[model samples]
Target: MTKSLQKSQSSPSLHPTRRFYWDTESLGVVGLFTALSKVVSLMVALLGGGMNPFTLFLKNGIATALLVVLVARVRKFGTLALYVLVGQIVSFLIAGGGMSMLLPSFLVAALASDALIAACGGYRRIGAVLAGVALYDLLGRAISLGYSFLHARENMAMVMVAGVFIVLGYLGCLVIGLPCGAKFVKELRHAGIIREV
Candidate 1:
């Protein structure tokens, strides 16, 4: 066989390398998701008048799960964290920075999610994606509740009760979100909308 022919046959087709930082598509996807999440959150807040903390937690948990899944499928590493940070910033500004306590909680959750995803071998693994989402939900809620107890003078017992409900919400969100995310990613890939990582 000719060397050129052999070389051509042996070499696989070249594919574009994945960029680590935000590309135009990645930024667009993240921005859309973040904006959608914020809108949903605002709607939830408006509709949650006099609702118990449990219900609120559940709504937020589900939203977070969906956002995490979408972001994970599109962009890996710090992308989701960036989304969280941007989301929080926008939300804070919208609320006139009255939610100062939530900033740290969100930052911690975002960082932890990114680290956990990285540690579990990237976004390809369902376990990593789910775990990252679960942690993000759990820590975010827990920290927010803790802040309320300390600063808002909320009753510890009441907060604990709410925590139980929040935990259940997180579980339900994880159970539902993971499969849905997997299916969504599959569809996106099949449609050539998103290339597999």
Candidate 2:
């Protein structure tokens, strides 16, 4: 009798049309991070560093950290990367910056950040991811500076200014992102939601 009962319980039916709130929570987190990244990016753009000393350091750093959060909190890195890239392409087109200046710079930042984050082990431990992200921003900005020096303007001062801004960008990431990422990871782990994704 005990064996039969155990068999029955083990074979209990699962609901065919059931739903859960897990995805809802995941998407909410994803949206929050993505929105924050966009706002930070807008601020960076307003600073107008693409052609000057800014070199979009803040923009890339924030964006990288945000993307890391999204990957850790919600979707896979590839999924969020594609979405970010699509959004960037559309936004750039609408803004109508000169393709010669915008296309390579945008591609460099997007691809580098994505690749770096992908290199980070696993989906959690956002600090490693953030470091990768910071590196991406730094590398892309360096590449852009090189491009400008070689083809666009050729000024040593411009390179120095861009370098400084890139450093500031990394510092900004360290300030605004490190705490939030650690907090989220803890929460997710406590909730047993880390394995859900």
* Candidate 2 lDDT by residue in tens digits, 109-196: 6566666666766445565566655555566556655655665365778767655766676655566545555666678668886665
On residues 91-194, what C-alpha lDDT tens digit does candidate 1 reach at each position? 77776676754776678788888799879877877677767877776787677667656654657777776567666666656665556666665677688776
After aligning candidate 2 to the native by TM-score, how far in Å is the CA of 167 from where it should be? 2.5
By summed lDDT, the worst window of 10 consecutive residues in model 1 runs over 12-21
Off by over 4 Å in 1: 1-20, 44-58
lDDT of 2 at 13: 75
TM-scores vs. true structure, each candidate: 0.73, 0.54
lDDT of 2 at 7: 75
What is the TM-score of candidate 2?
Answer: 0.54
lDDT of 2 at 193: 68
What are the runs in model 2 whose C-alpha is more than 4 Å off?
Answer: 1-35, 43-64, 99-120, 125-128, 147-154, 187-195
